[model samples]
Target: MMTAERHFLADDVPDRVRVGVADLAVATGETRVTTSGLGSCVGVAVADPESGVAGLAHVMLPDATGDDRGKPAKSVEAGVERLLAELEAAGGDPERAEAKLAGGSKMFDFSGVSEGVGERNVERTRTALGERDVPIVAEDVGGDYGRSVELIPETWTLTVTSTHKGAEEL
Candidate 1:
């Protein structure tokens, strides 16, 4: 009998393919994958089917600060913007791409964190996508458990897995 291989390590990012975490990636016929742990942080994936380009955004906040402007785009809004621009540069149509959101768990009580950064991140992402008219095809948000998310560019699929929750197909 043949034994199947048990996977452990992450697959490497393809050449000329960019993987974004609160960042962007663009590729044609190339697979772009990104992963993140969500303990409150929201994991966002944006993909353009035509270009086979995808990006991931691990956003921790709703908006960016003045200092953030100089830093790499990491906020929900800036992250999406950067992803869009990179996709456009890589021959992706902004109008053709769709978004997927995951993560954002109330794993711990913050006492008083003001706005629940996790929820804020989720709401901000929704608002941003709505404004751009980009449809959010799937999501796994707001819970008491942490999650890990992966975006596969080839199939434009976002998979969410968790220790206690097993796995969710999205």
Candidate 2:
């Protein structure tokens, strides 16, 4: 019986918040939202530089079938919508918002899986965002390694980090 582990930021970390898998976080000001160890999962971030409001969602699946209960951040469709709404509620202007995406890597090759989950996740994420008229400004997606991402709303920057590739800002 393996249980999910919840990691907390250090006491001195101030406004930095960590979002786990199948989770999302929204913040304003100089706060930074981060999520780690994203393989096939996708990290989607939306922010408004003028309002200083931003959000990050770690979506694990491409879409939600049947009943998804009430958690929207578990799938790309619901997750992107939920994040956009939250960002707006937090004072972000939808028209002025910019999105950044990262992760979604083919970390492994399965024997019988028809298509890679990473590709599907990326595609679905793009579709969802496009449907809502949110333009994706930057992306570091579709590769062979896992990545961690951080979003700074104040600066409207996304930093993607990988063990093999170091870090890049978008």
Candidate 3:
């Protein structure tokens, strides 16, 4: 008798990804990823429909201004710009690039500071996309629960899943 035993490695996993708050993801197929535990943080997903190139960013703050100069551009503006640059380098059409924004939930209690961050993130993301002239095809921002975002490059489809509520297609 022969027993079947197999172990799948990280590389064997589909193009799936897991992104944290204030973080971003960029790839050209060969991976399907997912992100979790996003509270008061915003997630940005960009993709070039024609080229099948896509990226995602989980952001915590708006612009890196106050006491955040030396650090990297984890803010909405900087992160999106970085994502776009990667897409462009991959031969993804700048004009054809479409963006999808998600997360930015109020996970804390009545803490004003915590609640405010999510709102600011949403606004900043919207503003940043506008400035770059990247059209937002879909979004799911501002809520009471954290979200998990999934991006499929081949289809240019982004799906957002929440903890309490059911999954919503964006």
Predicted candidate 2 versus true structure: per-residue lDDT over 28-71, tens digit per residue: 76678899989999999998778888888898889786565555
* TM-score of every candidate: 0.80, 0.87, 0.82
Model 1 Cα shift for residue 14 (angstroms): 2.3
- TM-score: the better of candidates 1 and 3: 3
Candidate 3, residue 51: lDDT: 79
User: What's model 2's overall lDDT?
Assistant: 0.81
Candidate 3's residue-wise lDDT over 51-70, tens digit each? 77777777667767565333
Number of the top-ranking candidate, with lDDT as the measure:
2
What would the C-alpha RMSD of candidate 1 be, to one decimal place? 8.0
Better candidate by lDDT, 1 or 2: 2
- True lDDT of residue 25, candidate 1: 43
Against the true structure, what is every candidate's RMSD? Answer: 8.0, 4.9, 7.9
How would you order the candidates by lDDT, starting with the best? 2, 3, 1
Give the per-residue lDDT digits (tens) of candidate 1, residues 1-170: 00011101124445333333444444444354555567677877777877676666666677786556332446778777766766666556889889888877777775775447788888988998888888999998988788877667667877788886788777
Q: What is the Cα-based lDDT of residue 150 in candidate 2?
A: 86
- Runs in model 2 deviating more than 4 A are 1-14, 67-70
